[model samples]
Target: MEAVHEGEIVDVHALIMSFPASNTGFVVPLPSENQECFLSGLKLLFKQAGGIPLSIRIDNLTPAVKKVRGSEGEAQLTDEFMAFKNHYGFKVQVCNPRSGHEKGNVERKVGYVRYNFFSVPPVIKDFDDLTEQLYQKFLIDRKRMHYRKEAIIEDLWACEQKQLLKLPDNDYSVFKQTTIKFNKYNEFKLDQHLIHVPKAKNYSQLYCITFWNEFKVITNEGEVLLSDARPYMRKRRLIPWKDILKDWVYKPRVVGHSRYREYLPARVREYLLTPSLSLRKQRINEIITLLVQYDMKGINEQFYELISKNDEVVSNPYDVEWSQYDALQPIGGENHEGNH
Candidate 1:
């Protein structure tokens, strides 16, 4: 499926689950088709159904199936997927290679969902909000009569829910943990995205724990260093500007060559590029302190307004009083107090 994500038209991974006997269907759109997304979608499905299915028939998806054996369809499941299945205690039936007919119902439901629900691409500002909206739509859809059962789909699904296995005491944690080394810029490449780790030493190895939509970088001693929303697209970079301001203050010259320099507001960038080293450091230090109480956007707006009033730089950009200008006006109205 395609969605407008953060102002860009991007492909979303749509996982469709169907209960053939009841014609009950569920769909979850994900940012990517990685293993975490695959397993997390199943977890959400189980939650929505209020119980786990006894057996799940799956296609040869890369996240679940490492390889399909002979014509009989014996398969080697990925270790993470195998662990998830064991945790849930469900049987996995892998469909034969190129055999869409085996899971024909679900394959058809995929198209059904695409046309009925996502015919028009949705604007996804928040992924969780989008998922909740889709869940509500599915509930409304279940109120209709089944295609062939002559019963309400929701009622049939209610009966099927009673036969499902009781949910586990706890949900499975879906994450992939690996060790990665940070580059000279204190950033590590994950899924082709560069994620900056604040205060991390260059060339240091850290534990990277990847979830469906986010990841965390931790030290060997289990201290969490950074957590950020993971980007699905390649060549994207995530930087925590506020957290790194202290480090950057010492290396003011590097700001000019930074990849993120272009993203800064022109006025703020120009302020940072001042020729006086002492002034640049002082202003950035003030910004770092101001960030604790106000966001960069607010600070930038205030700074821009202050600098715009005068051609020269304001010594204290953040602490200017516009009311002072009104104090300089005449005590009485201009027409009554004096001649023009």
Candidate 2:
């Protein structure tokens, strides 16, 4: 694990895997150490290697092993880990207790990966991007000749790849799927963070699949209704303000008394509370239309600045040049074409 030396001390855990025979290695960085992280790392390794190893050897980590009986005794593996092993058709071999020496190849890979990739303490903004780039860097190591065998690592891996087991046809989700009934507020709280469900299905039970960094709420029919990209180490509610405002456009009067009213921009709140209901509805509709091309905060901030400074409101809010407000919002992964 390495601490991301930015403002926050975010710890990024690297799951390192190496094939001793081929002298090939794979590393997958995750948010933290957990069952989900383990599963995601293994999935990434399988995708990169193009097949599953005959057997995976690792230290007795709690995520994989529930209990390590003894050198001669059977190792008790976690149910989830066992399921993963069964799906991939790989045998799980746990090193002896306190026997880091037993996994020498993987142990040496820790320093090799660190010195080559993590030594500079990668200046990265997105965890996914950092992991993806580092994986590509790892591929360069394959060009080097093996220390003992004196053969290129890439060529050896190519031969070893054919001997490995093929992946199962089924799609393996690295997250745990569960169901949750939406409360009266049309929302559900996971890990003390409240998330809004779709207004149409307020009271309906949805299938919630929780991942390491995010969660998804799907319909009973398997359609994804919402994808909540949760921020790490933050305990704040994530309400889809755009969705709520869209619904509020039909009933502008509710904008004043709704629980989420305070979250609206000051200018927008004033406009909605205007005594002229027709004008309020018109502006609300305009806001809903603006939501498609711009972020709510950017639109709200720019709108407030214009009305407050100029002492005049645009006759048609949508007609206003929105390009200036575009930069007010941060474009997060909007143009990301890189594959995960």
Candidate 3:
């Protein structure tokens, strides 16, 4: 599926599932067709359907099916997908290669959903928001009369629900676990994104647990170093500036080459880029301390005001009267004077 996401026309994956008996259909839009997305989509489908299907007729998608044996032989499933099936205790019914008629219902439902639900090429601001909207559309669609059956689609679906396998006590853990090494920047590359793991040593091995929407960097001792939302676009970098700024105070030279440098306010960036190494270190240290009490926006605004008033770079952190920035003060009325 192609949709306008954040004003960019990017390709998205749509998982379409349809029940032949009730003529009920489900469609889940995913960011990618990775194993995590495929498995997570199945989990979402099961949740929406209220129970797991006894047998799912599927095409030879790479996420699930690694290889199609032949026209009649059983398809080989990926290890993660095979484990997922075992956990849910469902049966797999792989459709034969080039045999579109075998699962014609879902194939047609895909076209129906593409035209009826996504005909306008939805302007998606948030992926989850789009998903919720589609789910509501499906619910409304179910209220209509079935194409072939006498009863409404929702009514037939209600009767078919009782025949489904009982939902398991616990949901399956859908994630892809792998070992990754942090680069010299204390960041690891996943897809085209550089995910920073603060405090992680450079060139160190760590466990990366990837989910459909987020990923976690784990230490060797199983300590979670960072758990952050994964970026959807390519060539993106996820940097926790506040956390990394603590480390940057010592390595002030590298601040110039930082990918996040341009993102900082102009005055703040100039303050950090000063030729005086000691001043840069002192300023960043103060900024880091201030960040503990206030957000980046507040800090940036205060710095902008201070620079505008002084008309010259504040040589020392102690020169500024921190109390004057009362509007940006932290809650609970904690005195910040002695902290400097």
Candidate 4:
């Protein structure tokens, strides 16, 4: 599928699964026509349908067919796709080479979707939101009478749903795993897109799990350090400013000289370079560490609130009771660390 997204042309694969018996269709947008996308799309479709079909008829696409056998023989399914089929307990039926007519049910469904959903050239801000709207539209359309079945499509789907295989006890993780080394700038490139990893050491290896909608980087022990929504724009750099601050805290002086300093809120920049505050290395480190624990916006609010008090004497930024800051609270509750 081709569409304009965020002022750029995006080329993606459309996975359309059609149930001829009920005239029901499930559509999933994939990043590519690769093995991972093929499996992920199917997994998402099954999850939405709540069950697997007894058998799935697929086109002889490159992702699914490693080698096409004779018309009478079973086409060799790619190992990854084969494993997915086995996990879902579904029979695989492949169409003959150049024989799209065999999967006409889904082909027409794709056309219908393209006409109804993509015809207007959607202004997509979020890829997930677009897919969700498409799915809801599909459901609403199913309330109509079936073209030839002489019954409501949704009603017919109810009957077809009864014959589907039950969902497996465990859900599948749909991602393509890769290892990448960070550059001196703590940046890594994926599919020509640059991603900045804050506080990452140069030459350190990071594991990435690429999904259809997003990608994540994890430590060697599998703790997720960074995650970003996959960008359609080529060669785009995704930088998390919060993560960037993790590195800036080590060099307090550089924070003032960096080009991003101007981007910081005025209160945060002023507090960092407050003339009245001691710039001793230990004091700088303490302020940096504390600021990291609290968002600049929240800290700025506190700064203004305190500065407004005529009765209170505020000398140094560190003089504030940062531990009492609301934003510093841990996710579950407050931290029980020693007094600051």
What lDDT would candidate 3 get against the real structure? 0.74
Better of 1 and 3 by TM-score: 1
Taking all chains together, the TM-score of candidate 3 against the true structure is 0.64
TM-score of each: 0.66, 0.59, 0.64, 0.59
Best-performing candidate as measured by TM-score: 1
Residue by residue across 1-340, what tens digits does model 2's lDDT show?
Answer: 4433221234578888899999899998877677877888889889888989999898999889988968578889999998888888898888888989999999999989888787644544567767787788978889999999979999998998898888889968778787786677877777666778767364356788878778888877888888866545342233466788778778877877875564454445555666777877777776776667655556655774544443345454443344653455333223221100
Report clash pairs, candidate 3: none
Candidate 4, residue 256: how far the Cα is off, in Å? 49
CA RMSD of all predictions: 15.2, 14.3, 13.9, 14.4
Candidate 1: stretches off by over 4 Å: 5-10, 71-73, 202-204, 233-340
Query: Which candidate order results from sorting by lDDT in descending order?
Result: 3, 1, 2, 4
C-alpha positional error of residue 34 in candidate 1 after TM-score superposition, expressed in Å = 0.5
Error of 2 at 213 (Å): 3.0
Q: Provide the lowest-lDDT 10-residue window in model 3.
A: 331-340
Report clashes for each candidate as comma-separated counts.
0, 0, 0, 0
| TM-score ranking of the models | 1, 3, 4, 2
The 10 consecutive residues of candidate 1 with the worst lDDT sum are 331-340
Question: Over the stretch 232-265, how does candidate 1's per-residue lDDT look in tens digits?
Answer: 7422223355766677689877777764454444
| Model 2: lowest-lDDT 10 consecutive positions | 331-340
The Cα error of candidate 3 at residue 242, in Å, is 36
**Which one wins by lDDT: 2 or 4?**
2
